[model samples]
Target: MADSLRRIDSGEASDDYLRGGGTGAVWRPPPAKRGALLQEALVRRPGSCIRRLAQGDRARQMQFSRFLHNGAVTVTEMAETAAARTAVVVAGRDVLAIQDSSELVFGGKEARARGFGPIGRGGNLGGLLLHSVLAVDAVTGALFGLVDVKVHNRRGGKVAARRARSTADKESQRWLDGMFSASRVLHEAARITVVADRESDIYEEFARRPANVHLLTRIAQDRRIEAAVDGSTMLFAFSDRLPEQARFVVTIPAAPGRRERAAELALRYSTVAVRKPKNGAAPDLPNSIVLTLVDVTETSVPEQGEPIHWRLITTHTVDSPAKARMMLDFYRRRWIIEDYFRTLKTAGFDIEAAEIQDPDAMVRLVAAVAVTGVTVLQLVRARDGTTDQLLRDAFDPADQPLLETISATLEGKTQRQKNPHPKGTLAYAAWVIARLGAWDGYYGKPGPKVMRIGLQEFHSIKYGFQLGLRDV
Candidate 1:
């Protein structure tokens, strides 16, 4: 590692990207050398292990592993830096702190690894649960970055036993941890709406949010209402009685055993006092709190299956139909993080499939690669008429020229097959790489998976390109 980085000082350095440049201004790792090595190792290869990134050099791979094990470089510091960078991205926009958790499955010689917890089907697998919060501009709907990520292991116990514990002590804490972290880091944003699914519907989470930070989560708790609008009715019953105010159409993505389809949904909303739950009570929560409840149900039943239904609770005022619709839109963006997890686990980074046995190293690798995962998503998402900003906004200065040189070479049969977005824009670069990764060189846009494979290939090209320059 020292030998490679030393080239930088002697004008022998090909470039920082080649030198491993994932370490950015947000992090402040001690003995800056570790920071440099990490950047080089991560950037040189999007998701490859130390051995692969180090060109199959076993000793070098051990050095890379040792660097992660060093006490000087802490995971909190790395995560904090990532949060700081995300804060900068969330500066002025009304953003959605989209949070969700996914379980990572790993295998080894033993089912129960020392550092890992029971995982997978029947708890026979070993792995970690990654709960992450990604920031998205609420108004413009642009991807910012990941503001918070909480990785933890589930302890061996009956599901009922785990649920009986305190919310703060259980896995549910990840929701609060994500919300508070976003509020603290992106505090300057116009408004931060913490968005998540039903799993995030915790009473403690609602009671704990800071001012200017609202939560938009699907309601799971059916707490009794103190003052029903018509009678002593529960949440769903009260919501059911409200007249449908608006009708809209929503597109549902394809899932296992389900085909992608569009459905016409009827929106029902009501202003109600959300009563406290009888079970797992929190001291700070009032007996009942005023909140806007919005329900979007597929009034039109689909041909084959259940229609889409989302019961949402929010602190944001949703008195008007437009506001209600906008809130639903915000909730919909929660899927962006879900797509992000796919990118991490599938083609791009494959952090879940990582074979590293050491828990700390695995954490370090995931944390470092997560930054790139965010960037890859940004590149792909920005193609949807979001920004005309140049590729320099996302790619390194050194990578631009190489990308440009290859862009024309990767073009399709006609001009339409080539990238039409502004030159140097992130979308243009994405187009070129997508072409390199076997996208139909024409106008059919590439998805996250295609973009990731392009990036992985681009890194190899860039790595060899930089090494070749060293000969000069």
Candidate 2:
């Protein structure tokens, strides 16, 4: 199936079946076949628009247009495909299902006509809200893939109060929904830890966690909890009273107006019984839920910027300092999803810039782009040999020969020109692709953009290789 698609993409075979008449009207194959082809095309070339993806081929571009607009192309099916791929790599491994949300804002006079709700500025702009679950190896922080994605548009209106609506009706439901989706997708994993930000701190989310899954979230609300010393007290106040366990230094990355510096942070953690909110109580839920709260606060004042403070709540055991540090490490994986969003948006794919206009089609395209972004990330991580991953982790077993062929051709007589990583490792493949993208082997590592371009060229070569096999 993939070979046939590759032949068509390489222009070695005619796309007559993809066109209706001599004039080149759009025609599609069976729904399943068409979907498969569309998925292949998107993965072959990651770009902002269908025209560029089609590379000026009228038939291919029209085919993508039809596929996106087709009612059968549902987000659920796309998400399931991504989940299945992730499940393969994450099986028997402790996985971190990091979840986060981002806004895709489209700016233009016709942006409002694109059928999306207002995003930025005074309910006047247009865009869609996206929430995604990125699966990562808990031990190595190596990205696996996206397990779930939910894209929605907010309706323009006078929004009701948060308490007025049931949890089902509120947009915050995405957090809980994303967690369950991750659990269902990664059921074979040894352990599944769902990590997220403060927005995911919900009573029902903690109360309804499955036996195999655990939740780790940055504390958002200062809810009432049963104090270790005595009666109920606010979460923040209770945490403030706990004695500091130890101090650790972490390098704070450079940000706007903040030079990178090592921050000495004091850590405190203890188990507490969190009282459920009285206002939005469900009938079957318990009055309180037990959770370990870990408070991480920077002890020293920095020359610039605010001090670091994080109150984290989790279901994982944090009795000892090592366990507490492990929980903190898990929370750090949230940055992986943030980096993914950056790749999907401004930094790499720039999906918002795509010319796709319809809301439904836009949602489907965003989901596809979300999946494609994983490939770039895998290569970026593999650019350095520390990941200890195999080529099969990112590329198919069949592509090994082509990767080897490309790697051999890229090597020069000099030692520096040769691939430094071991053969058959993902790093070796990355080195070959980086060379294809014009990156000097001796210079800095290949980033996402370099890897993305290299991947595009690799797929193009793969298509030609597939055509050559047909002749042989």
* Off by more than 4 A, model 1: 1-36, 156-165, 228-232, 387-393
89-152 per-residue lDDT for model 2 (tens digits) = 7789998999999989887447777678888767577898999898888988777777888888
lDDT of 1: 0.71
TM-score of 1: 0.87
* lDDT for residue 51 in candidate 1, whole number 0-100: 68
What range of 10 consecutive residues in model 2 has the weakest lDDT sum? 17-26
Error of 1 at 14 (Å): 20
Q: When superposed on Cα atoms, how far off is each prediction in RMSD?
A: 5.1, 6.2
Question: Residue 133, candidate 2: how far off, in angstroms?
Answer: 0.6
Model 1 Cα lDDT, one tens digit per residue, 342-436 = 87887477777666777766766666666567767776777655744345445665567888888877766777766677776677777777776
